[model samples]
Target: MKYLIILSLIIGLSCSERTLLEDYVFDDNDISVVKHEILSSTVNQGYTLHKLNLTSLKWFNELLTNRPIWWHHVYVSVPDNLDSTRPIFYYIDDGRNNETESPSETAKLLSEFSTKCKCITVIQRQIPNQPIIFTADPKSKLRIEDDIIASTFGLFFFNRTLFPNNTYNNVPLLFPMTKAVKRGFDETVKFLKSKNVNFTEKFVVSGASKRGWTSWLITAVDQRVIATMPIVFDLLNWQKNLHIQFKSLGGGYTYATYDYFLVGLTAKLDTKEIREILKLVDPLFYLEKYSGRKFLLFSATEDQFFLPENTKAWWQDLSIQTNNQIYIKRLANVDHYLNQQSKLQIVSDIKVFMDLMHKETSSTRTLPILKWYFENNILFGATRIKLSNLGEFDSYTVTSYSAKTKDKTKIDFRVNYLLDKSFVDSNISWIEAPLIQSKKSDLAAVNEHVYRKLRILSIFNYVGFYLDVNLKLKDSNETLSISTDLNIIPEYYPIGDCYNEECLGKLV
Candidate 1:
């Protein structure tokens, strides 16, 4: 009966409205123009830049059809002297919720890049009392659960006539924002074409921080995007990275409260389940699937949001899997904001990569690869895997056999540390060792030299785990290491128990 009412409400919408909803939901088509007007234009640094005010409508779902939205399009054209055959570079501006009227500082920075390369910037205007689309805010009336159900059904209906074994519900948390941004870009392209602006189909998508995350999503779903360069954003390996952040900086550092927190999907699911859902929109999934595209990851060593270790680990894994199609550059001493020198270096790197890409015809191009190696050792309570480069490659994969069944199960390894050589060389500790994970089983020592100790810290007041290890390396030197893991059991406390100050205080 409820579904009937929804279907009737959808059917009652105007013809144009129904068409808009049908096009957005059923067809993977980009935005069709309802209205477009150039708000302003200025000639700057040998290029003509136009600011367009566009009103567009897209189908959100059955509950919300022909959803009206607005966008600010900033289009920059190639110089008169320069050939119009240049590639297009599209950037999504992160307005930071402050720039309500004009583009943010990052958008201006992209314009500077536009002086040399043809650039298009898409910025979503903040509308007062606008319905929340991207985030599954807990306080929202529509609720995250409803959004998930609608999206799942919508996607399934669009993709398959008959229901399959499993439905792809891993749609990105930022799907609405990314989709709107993509639509705006598509509209801008059409507007440019209408104005007789000549440009190549080779599109490069780049963004910084949150916008960087969007860039990854845009490139993943949109085949029109030929290359992607994301700054200060690491791949989603949420289980390990989120756990570390939660322990080090409390629950707030993970940004779990944000609407885009895996699109609020994690609130109801466990770690493993959340990972499965994230596979729909995670950059790792797309990067691996589209291994032929050019990917450049720019990160800072001292970035507060994205840990340097996690960034390196993600890059290492991607490097191995993608066969070095991905290029990574980690700047030392630079934070996420990136100072003047770092910014200059970033622009230079972009130019270099784009130039190389323009010259190549094939999708698969050989990029510089990082050399590294791994070793797996069976330990008492956990598997210890060591990854070392030291100017040479030395990595290995570990597989475990069950004692009773003898069935081989590959151990999933997560790095806990990449110890510095200087620390190990000072007669202080032996070779660098990293703690990894293996199949859950009875604790037993596979190596005579390695010893493991585990203890549960306070569970009533504050939940934590302490692990201490003493190991003798190949050189006969022994060292002791201590690590801690902290988490709140979901069943004990509600899923988002630590989100607010009041709830957090109660946990103590």
Candidate 2:
């Protein structure tokens, strides 16, 4: 019945001289677009469905070149039982299209141990060239999450060419792209509402690293989302960073959000108009408006690219300015990409927080292990896994794994051991080898002393996990190292403890 009404409503929507569908899609060619690969999955939430899709480079090239394009795939994990109300979890990937999958021991373990009511998934691909925008070609190739437009929790991809000249500066900034992505996101939300999709409840926005910066701006741009979580948040003055990187003037002829170009007054208009536009587009200048939203930011305190002080200042102001609560959890001695245990902790923590906000009951019953298979062969940030306890020792190892996608490698330690300080022993033979990007790296360890106290370090490159470490002792003098893996299992929490589903309104 609701679907019938929604279809009818969509039919009645007045079309502009150029309809949105027509503006983006020209004909069957657009609709029939194919990619190097496409991957998908489905999950059931009470009131909504959730889905994920991974695309290929062909899809990205079409969009980058200003061709009429269709998003490569859609991920639809909707609710099986419509009457019941449960919050939805949505995830999207940013970068060039390349569908690839790898077997991950850590991701699999985390999924297996994660809470049943909550969903953890990914849609990833190898994105080459970091979506550059140069003076010769100033265009945004980033795509919004067109797949799950009907979802209440709309987690879309936010891509921007802040420093158009720096191809390596994939680190996201929070200014211009926010407005464009928010505009599209709000339209999607309006569409869902017209379809009678009940989104009046809590809404959550989340992203990892660059996407995390996008998530931050989304929460600020739209105060409607109840909560936000940006894993390994990275935000810097992109234009300045680019200027420093390429040793030239930053930005380009125009600014772009994803693959679309938006007119910038600096290039196309006067200086006064540029200042006027800056008032609206600058995220830092517009921070006061986001006071009602709650945020849970998870980042490695050790992450170098994203400064802890900067994030702390942002979090502090948000808390002081906002009427709602702010939860800041900084994982000690971790990097931009968390270790296996920390990753599990991230999923568990996020689930608990969302479940509480949504008023959903967490089950005490045992849940089957979920294997989160994300296939995108790109790694962002540092690949070294830093341990909380072994911060003093820069522990490195030669762990072996296979490629999940063309852009990613899978690492499996294949060891059954829990990480502990006692396992550190001198019998461990060690040699440090230079890291390689594509093929297996050298197994020789240069620093023999570092291995005695070292446990493991999983080398990663964007798309997913790449390598694992195995410690074997050949002599009695050598000590064994501890190993740990994360699991995704159901969590048990008390139900119906509070009837304050309207806590958000109370904050207002």
For TM-score, the strongest prediction is 1
Give the alpha carbon lDDT tens digit for every residue of 30-122 in model 2: 223323222323342232322223222122233333322323222322333332254434332354433344424433332333234344222
Which whole-number lDDT from 0 to 100 does residue 46 have in model 1?
A: 65
**Pairs that collide, model 1:** 373-394, 373-395, 374-394, 374-395, 374-396
- Give the distance in Å from residue 331's predicted Cα in candidate 2 to where it truly belongs: 1.4
Off by over 4 Å in 2: 1-72, 79-83, 98-115, 118-202, 234-282, 359-508
Per residue, candidate 1 scores C-alpha lDDT tens digits across 1-508 of 9999988887667322421112222345434544678877777776666777655444343333223244444445444444455567776554322235666555666666665544443334421113334333344443332243335434433433332343233233355556655665666778778878766655677777766877777776666777788887774665455443433333333222233343333343343545554555456655444455667777664454565445533555666655656655555446668888877767766765565455455553323232322222232122232222111111211222111101111010111112232211111111223344322231232311222322121122222111222221223232111111111211132122232222222100
User: Which candidate should be chosen as best, given lDDT against the real structure?
Assistant: 1
Indicate the residue-level lDDT of 135 in model 1: 32
Backbone Cα, N, C clashes tallied per candidate: 5, 55
Q: What is the Cα-based lDDT of residue 291 in candidate 1?
A: 51
RMSD of every candidate to native, in Å, equals 15.8, 20.7
